[model samples]
Target: MSKNPLTTILEANIFNGTNYNDWLRNLKIVLDFENQTYVLDMYLPRALPEESTHEERLTFEKWHKDNRKVCSIVLASMTNDIQKQYDRHDDVRPIMPRMSQIYAVPDQHIRYAATKVFFDTKMIERSSVQEHGVKMLYLVEKLGDLKADLAKEMYIDVILQSLHPSFDSFIVNYNMNGFDKDLHELINILVQCKATIEKSAQSVLVREASTSKAKGKGARCWRRNKGKTESTTASAQSAPVAPLGMGKGKRKAVRQSLIPKDVCINCHEKGHWKRECPKLLPNQAVKLISANGLQVVNRSRRLRQTVLKFSNGRVVATLV
Candidate 1:
């Protein structure tokens, strides 16, 4: 218990009312790792019945102890607002099933969150550009799954915008040429470009090292050229880096998703999905794309990223 596996997962991802699905899976993983999953599967009676054998009583005692441990872990994992509501008096099922109901937000909120995350996503420093690009693609896919309308150009631009400044030249060239390419092709081009930039940097380093080796004439010549270098450096530093995606006043735009026709399962009427059916039962809850639903969305700060770093030292970041 001293080394809880849930700590790391919880540190990165808290329940926070919005990410229950992820928290639930992570908690389950903790239980499974500790060989305590039976606490959830085997429901025990509050008290032993008369004539119950010693074996039955022993099983009940162990189950009760394990259930309390799991319940404590569950409550500790949740945020204060949520933790205060659940009373730990019985098996874990009673508590979790109700939470599943309470944590679900409206589709309108989900749609808004998804859209915001797509726009605000920025590539992490030292991470793979291809990975960053792929994550952007996944965000677009999530928007699509939510039935949010988006233009192809917006999708492409959003990914391009997420990249770091190392890709400014590439972005400018791409915008100028107006090449029509999908997300996969775009990622490939970025991978190649990153390699090229790194190579150029390596060659610069090699030339500098070789020049330093010639201490006599080379050192004298280098010192003589210092003034010219100083002037060039000052001029280069003074000229600001231009923002990308500018050609004939090219600017970024995000269009609202076009609504598709829907047929309600409950009412058998057009213009609506099951989630918002007008004739549903009082206790029925319709699911969206999957059982987990809309997935927990991150509302990251909106970013105006200008740098596409050429750092590939880290592994590729996957879309979780």
Candidate 2:
């Protein structure tokens, strides 16, 4: 293939079909691609071996050794074009050790200006909760006692705006129902503010599941060994662990009474349930009367007697 001097290095096999990041990583080692016309002040300074971890230092050393003939070496410092105020020397010192094990030290901040960003599904699932949680918690902690809904909304918006390209992808295969639509809409609304709804929701459910399982297993095991000699002795020796924060005012949930399947409230029949009742109320006198044959009867006295007997289930004797 016919190629110009500027484009000759682009043909190098290092970039064979790899993604943007992988291609950049491979090409950086195999070829010197920096243009002589570009000024150093325009570009952000690269981290030096002295401040970087062992692996990073090694990588930097290797890159310099390979490209020493073409590119000049410069230390990352306060003089460099800092993308953020927090990107200063002292601020990044605590995070340097993590570079030994990590492949990339990506700045995850949601910057107002254009900057480098990337995303992967694996990272989304793994650190989505922690990263977003930290952001939300930081905001909430900073705001302290201010309205939670407002704080959450603001935080979620920040996170959504800060989303890496990969996380913004939409999968159209799944068919969502009304409930799913509502939850997703809520999550999206929250996501727009900076709060991680999905991760936080998942974490809460997982926590409850684990706690419930543990309690169930403990109760089952305890019951199984209730009469055993070792368990009896252990129980007798150890002091009981009292429940925390439980008080007389705190009420436990009462399970709802089950509806009888074969009973009908409308018909007073024993075939179907109250929920399936289809009868409509008839328009009649509110009070039913046994006025077929009456011999000078007092309505109020009779009504009082009927009410007393119906309420107490007792028939009082009357002198004739």
Candidate 3:
């Protein structure tokens, strides 16, 4: 026996209370493939009476058989729950329409829902502008299917309004130019705008990352320099001083080594030599030298004093 064509083909989607439209659409494809779609269209001839002519009788009988086969195919595709509701109807025409009415949403309700979805949809941060625009278009198509009166401008507005703030500039320019664009044109513009925005955002992120890295490096360098300065200061304060009789060369070398490289030995300030230091007056310079504990070896002088040693080997006397 030949395999049943219905069994050979992939089974149509079984109606499950809902999804009547999708199920019906798939069922039509199957029926069309099997050359049994005539039953749904009510084109199949009815059975003839006994008094009919021989040719007429044969034609009616063949159509009757085809009609019954188509009806069985439709019934087989339905789930048990949906099948029970329309199984009493032997003709596919009445059965299909009745099932559609029972399961499909009313036209008005679909339109209302589509309108609400179209207007209420807003772009979220997680979704790109292209994704948001696509969703808007899908809702517009749904409305169009219901014969809803939606103008091109209205749809463009809907899509534009649903966009995230990232497209603010585009929106402003679009409104300023009063550009009249159809759905396709608007979608293309939105796609390009989204690409530019994403690219700009990526560039900004890269710059910020590089800037942050540079700042971090600078902070680390500053911290390292500060630490070296503090350590040098602490070591200078803690270092044991050599006896007074130590040669000027050895004493000067030890003092210079203990002091921070940036600090001046004469004025104890940074960034200038003692000779050119404006802050160090002649008296202040003498006091600074006396504070260093350098005593002058003068047996003839009754008063004890300290001497300031310059880098050029010049010595100046100051009373302690």
Candidate 4:
């Protein structure tokens, strides 16, 4: 065996029961660099030939040595549990295929997962459109790697559909113009559209703030006016009630009404009850003085009328 002083370790991520494809690719690259990849490609014979040449023996010995190295690299990359499963194998070729059987995902499942990424990804609140566009492109690239049957235009459509509703008009404009855009072109257009949307959103917020301020001021004014009206009514109600029959030139402000609810039995004038008339002295029947200085007194009777007499003995004033 030619010991060509190979010192390159497998510069690969550890395979923790997942990421089998990545780990496998890294393993191959490292093995190829070390000239040990043939150990994986060729199958070993059950035993050395009985009458083999020195060249055949050397080939078997070289293969056997490289196979051990490859197996060592594979086991080093796997987790403890997974390494135990493949470490028993003497041939390096079967180990890789066997590991693949356990860890490698099916093509259909990978395709489903990639398709789900396209549908599940979206531009959300407070997220940048540039980031959203870039992410969408990345997923499309992944799908392409998996040989997904989506066309280039379908990639553009999927990104547009996944964007926020603020881009609804932008999408419509894109479709109406019928422009063919690659992923990068779409991303560039979205960046510009994002700026426009943000500018318009700022302007709308300013207008809304102004409108709300106006509404708030109007509401305050209305409440102030309502309070003033209530205060005026309260002041008018609590003001002193004056005597009835004020002269037009000397009248005090009348609040509700000068008349009481009960009829005046003495004057029969309905302004107040029997003795409560302003014309009566306290504890006296209602009395009115005639032009001749004679006093007419009222004695309340069931009859509604009382007659008055003057000093000249004439029936001058009659009250009913």
Candidate 5:
């Protein structure tokens, strides 16, 4: 006598009408594996004394025992209300159908709900298109289980309808060449399309960033050039008046005007007096003054003639 295999295992998962089909299918597999599926079938009719044998009696007893065991396990797994309602029944057949009819939601309700979810589903901006497509396919499966199955074409159409306007070109191209593709194929194309769009957007952002950087650099360059131009103007404004063909009194007045003001006269730079200028080296200072078309004058009392030469070979005479 082989012991029942199901008795050795842990209790099966409780069945509520919610996942009745799956639970029932698993239970059937367990029963079949144990060679006790006869428990689910109708009981045999009573045998006459003349027709009955010892082996037949034992077989019937074993079948009845196995049937009672299966029923008890199923009842134990149910919720309180369902357990109480079905607990009195010792046979599997009556309990199975009654529980199914009482607990399972109507196919019409499931179909309507599934259809609503399928059509209302849209790809959110933050969510990947693949994830949205997956959710849509799951809803389609729910509809299929409720006997409202959609064809491949209908599935594609629903997904396309749910897409946002950004995907219009993808939708159009998909429609042109996607007649023979399945659900997963369509999802793959949408995913690729999404990646392409993102890549293009990233490229645009990079280009904009480059353009902004260039504009910033140009602005900085302009500011630098403007500062140089302003410094040149200030230097020219503070320049000494030329002493060409002027009298001693006029030369003295021009010398007074050439005295250092706010910035160095030699370098024309701020933050120091002309005598303290870093570029006031004997050779460099003369070259800088000559470059600016200016000449140095000494304040000696002797009437010595000093000649100042310019880059264009023009000479100016000043008396000191």
Candidate 6:
């Protein structure tokens, strides 16, 4: 068959195939955008093995090596582009908002960490002039239960003693009493109460504070008596101390632990005689006070807390 010279030449070129694998190996040298500025992504396939295999199988190890080379090139190019953009800046870029210098401290004078405090003052009438052969002395007498309004003052005195290790002789409020009770023992009990309340209250405060602050609100509950809210306590101060049989036991005292004198054999709780126990009575539902002081009706659930406080600084607490 007669053929044109150009067609014959093209057929001859197709027949003579080039070795692509060899071409890749020769281009193995790394190329930088500007001398050592940055590198552009490039890949080069490795030469084939000398031996032949009946089953052609691709392996992840080989694929990964090629992928790594390609990634490094891309990364280098990105780095170069960013550096160029930064160099072209004509005006000074504003600094990022100074990283917040977070701290656990608050910047306020009246703020307190943990510890209940109170201030107290009282007026007493006394003879100012000394009669003949009489030695009249001026004394500042301690009287009255520290009132709520003066709590801040009392807090200062306590805080001072706590801050000054040398003032160890200063007695905390709970240890001071007119009665002959052992002051040391009373102080220990008070310490335990303070510690417990401090820990729990701080946790609650921290959480609430964080949430409130996040929502652009004040961190404080703003309630002076945040934890105290009961009617009985409010009435206790004015309510004439009921006779010995009437005053409920105060659990703050460490000497005695409170427990039900009589357990229903059916259910256990104080303020109830076994016979009067609702659990023992057939078909009679039992209504009991919960930890929150809410009345819940149940036969199996036991009462959680024994102490009850009133708003008036009176507490009805039980020792466990």
- In order, the Cα lDDT scores of the candidates are 0.76, 0.41, 0.76, 0.78, 0.76, 0.34
Off by over 4 Å in 5: 1-73, 80-84, 87-90, 149-151, 227-256, 260-320
For every model shown, the clashing-pair count is 7, 12, 0, 0, 0, 10
lDDT of 5 by residue, 1-320 (tens): 56556543324556765767656656776677777777776576444365789898888788878887788767766668767887778778788877678766667976887798888888777678888988987887777878885687888788898987889998788678746787888888889988999999999999999999999999999999999999999997887666579998888867765655577777888876765677666877788877665333333423365666788988775654
Off by over 4 Å in 6: 1-179, 213-320
Candidate 4: tens digits of C-alpha lDDT, residues 47-127:
797999999999999889888887877787778888788777766778878777888988789889989989889899779
Name the regions of candidate 1 deviating beyond 4 angstroms: 1-18, 21-97, 124-126, 215-217, 220-320
Output the better candidate (1/6) by lDDT.
1
Looking at model 5, residue 122 earns an lDDT score of 82
Per-residue CA lDDT of model 1 for 1-320, tens digit only, reads: 47775567765766789787568768888888777888866777889999999999999898888888888778877788877788544457688778878886656877798899999988887788888877887888878877998899888998889888888999999999989998788889999999998999999999988777766677788887997899999987875544575553333211111357577877889986775675664435445434334443222212222234448755444332
Candidates sorted by TM-score, descending order? 3, 4, 5, 1, 2, 6
For every candidate, C-alpha RMSD to the true structure in Å:
50.4, 31.9, 14.5, 13.7, 13.0, 42.2
Q: Mind giving the per-residue lDDT tens digits that candidate 2 earns over 203-282? A: 99999999999999999898778758677788757734335675533322111123335767778987665545555322
**TM-score of candidate 1 to 2 decimals:** 0.41
RMSD of candidate 5 to true structure, Å: 13.0
- lDDT, residue 29, candidate 2: 38
Least well predicted 10-residue stretch by lDDT in candidate 6: 132-141
> lDDT score of model 5?
0.76
All candidates: TM-score: 0.41, 0.16, 0.63, 0.57, 0.56, 0.14
**Clash pairs (backbone) in predicted model 1:** 149-257, 149-258, 164-307, 164-308, 165-307, 165-308, 166-308
